[model samples]
Target: MRTKAKRAGIACAISILIAGAAIGAPRDVPTGDGMYANIKTTRGEITVRLEFQKTPMTVCNFVGLAEGTLAAAGGKPFYDGLAFHRVIADFMIQGGDPAGNGSGGPGYKFPDEFDPGLRHDGPGVLSMANAGPGTNGSQFFITHKATPWLDDKHTVFGRVVQGQEVVDAVKQGDKIEKITIVREGAAAKAFKADQASFDAYLKDSGGAAAAKAKARKDADLATIAAKYPQALKTASGMRYLILKKGTGAKPVAGKTVSVNYKGMFLSGETFDASDLHGGPIDFQAGAGRIIPGWEEAVLDMQVGEKRLVVLPPELAYGERGAGGVIPPNAFLVFEMELVKIK
Candidate 1:
């Protein structure tokens, strides 16, 4: 819990935050509040808006990062001159690494506040991009289209208030021209509407909540794996592990399962990642685009499940290796979570 002074410092950075850990609920709802916006790097100009009422802390933290107030609070800026890093064909543009290299962070990590109510149904929504749940810090992304896969897992704090065109023009390696943080709480009318929807989800399927949570955990793992493949690891003395069960719905092939995951190497070196963007990552089952190891495990996942996947070099980057982050012919480990399937 945040102390009274820490809560106040959230707005002013004058108070100390001793242990503002993740206030776990379900695999839904974003942690933090207030609203914020990003000036962003675009071909021309674009401004994104954040809905603070729904995620006050997330928004407030964003604002603090933008205003250089985080530095005052013993934290460094995570967004300073960061790249839009990764850009999918028509999805979103990602950035916000203090290291400027993909391996950097905000000098601190924070827990996730998942409400399972907010969704990634469409474009303009801004969600916290992290290595995993409770690992969110200062990274964020802006969606270019309606990516329902992002619903209920990532911390979504704002939306593109206007200037989505700017997002349309962003390309890989594009520099963030500038990001202007703004405060615009959720519309009074929309607040009630969103809240009602949240309540409805809670009331309608009380029994399925556990199932949904498992699905979300699985989805989250998938998200982390896609982006940080190097993070995958195998048990000592074991060459690899197979997914081995459950394939009723082919998550890789359709909207059945959308996940957020992190990947690592045996040495714990991070190789790749996907959460830096938004949802665990939306893809079809058996899509040949990813590494073979992923192809084998994901097809077996159900919604809301989190699992660890370890692969031998034969199934991973092979001999050439992924180059930079991953070494030549190495074992890998992945912590995957399937957040949703719809």
Candidate 2:
């Protein structure tokens, strides 16, 4: 398995071959032409360094919309204070839904701008969201982890330049006050220049590097999972139930979903669950909005559905467990019920 460094090196090497524009300042406000600036939110502000030189249409699509007024922007940059829409504590934070609700997009599709040069491995590395091939439109994601799978499948045209904490601070219901796009000259450069200090913080946290070994392991499992029941191993000594199986209208990638679940440790101790007054942990599937395991399991179920998922050590919390109750490396049993599939 490639180490995180190896993966990034490989990504950088590939970027050169494909001619995807690279960021000189890896951790700044993105110092590229025609990018976004003064991206204000109730939480704070940040900026984006886009790769218009490589992805003209994609950048134009975003910049064109963000630069114009709600009506002038030809629509809304992001309608009415939208939430991150999809968040996975340490993986990524995705939002910018103009519909005010999660189920909205730019309402079109374009061929992928697959630049082997760029990667989604570092913090703030932005990538486009898609339903499938040639389907990218308005939805985008900001990585909190090094997502190697998105190397060439999606168009990763930019990265955040500042206020990544502001990005991480955004909660489930947090709204995107608005997004503004400024050219790469003064305004954008100013934001991109702030990354040296921010990059210092990033270095303390291990720089743009991420837990890639985990991503690779998960990727292997993801392949196994993509095959699904066929690859589902009953194992030698396990007693588990198929709480449910989902194969309904796939939850669109940018929409929110409501689900309730009861999780128990191998020794019969309950650790984490979604049956709370806080309501369902609503988020979009496949957008790193939740754990990778959760993303894989929920894609098939329809509305008003449920499933019993018995996850092995790798799929569950793994060696880190939830502490106190669940032991490290313990398998888990979950009785998951999907309440609303919006």
Candidate 3:
């Protein structure tokens, strides 16, 4: 009886070992002829097959940011230590903000690039997240399931070719260890992911119209500036004319200030005004609650002072301008009055 019991115990142990081996079997890594992004995370590595050909600009932006080839990244990998700031089970995981919030971006915005053939049909779909049309930036999200409602709204640039499990396992605040670009085949190997490459792609892909629009905008700004030959210019490219001087103390950073303003385009057509919002709006100075132009101008003004400020695209909205009221790369003009400082 003791011998028989020993044999049965040995057999049970063998079965358990086989079961564990089956459970821990290695998953197959995907093989393809295109470029891939191996996004190494705390959970595991997720390999994504980038649709480089279909969405050239979007893929260029992603690859540039990942490899630190883009000038915007300042010669350092942008996503090495960023967190997956937004995560929802059975939905998607979003990240790539330096501020680790939904409100931040890469200090610039690009227009959307879309392909009708690409759709959010299943999980592991990688796409850009924007506030609206023409606001594509550094932030991206990977879907956990089919999010068809997002079709055409967000630019789908790639899909997870392997490690969907890792994507699903990610939680909010999970660190993205690094993203390595892998090129397969001659075509993928020859593709250059850099600012120059992106510029060339833009030129080839209907950038002439955009260039023309920018030239017109620049000429309009020059005309506006020529009219104000005495307008004070700042190192940061802001032009202002002090219309009225005040006797009250000047506002400083962290101080609450009330300001009435009329925002207009280069043509002097008003797009926004304080009267529309009931009265002068109150906000903390230098807190970034308002545009950079307003922040810079207010710091130099005393209570009851009024100024006519001209803001370049960099100081105002950059590429992604304010809603429909403002166009991309628009130069904004504001007649601002500093009412009271608290």
**Best-fitting candidate, scored by lDDT:** 3
Model 1 Cα displacement at 182 (Å)?
3.1
Extract clashing residue pairs from model 3. none
Please tell me which model should have the higher TM-score, number 2 or number 3: 3
Q: If both were scored by lDDT, which would come out higher, candidate 2 or candidate 3?
A: 3
* lDDT tens digits by residue: candidate 2, 11-35: 9998885442221112344555555
Candidate 3 lDDT at 102 equals: 91
For model 1, what is the C-alpha lDDT against the true structure?
0.59
1 versus 2: better lDDT goes to: 2
Question: Judged by TM-score, which candidate is best?
Answer: 3
Give each model's whole-structure lDDT.
Answer: 0.59, 0.61, 0.87
TM-score, each model? Answer: 0.43, 0.43, 0.56
Q: CA shift at 248, candidate 1, in angstroms?
A: 32
Instruction: List the candidate 2 regions with Cα displacement exceeding 4 Å.
Output: 1-34, 69-80, 100-102, 186-342
lDDT of 1 by residue, 115-229 (tens): 5557776777778887644566667788888887656457877676555666776788877655655443345223322323433433444445457655754664575456555
Residue 228 shift from truth in candidate 3, angstroms = 46
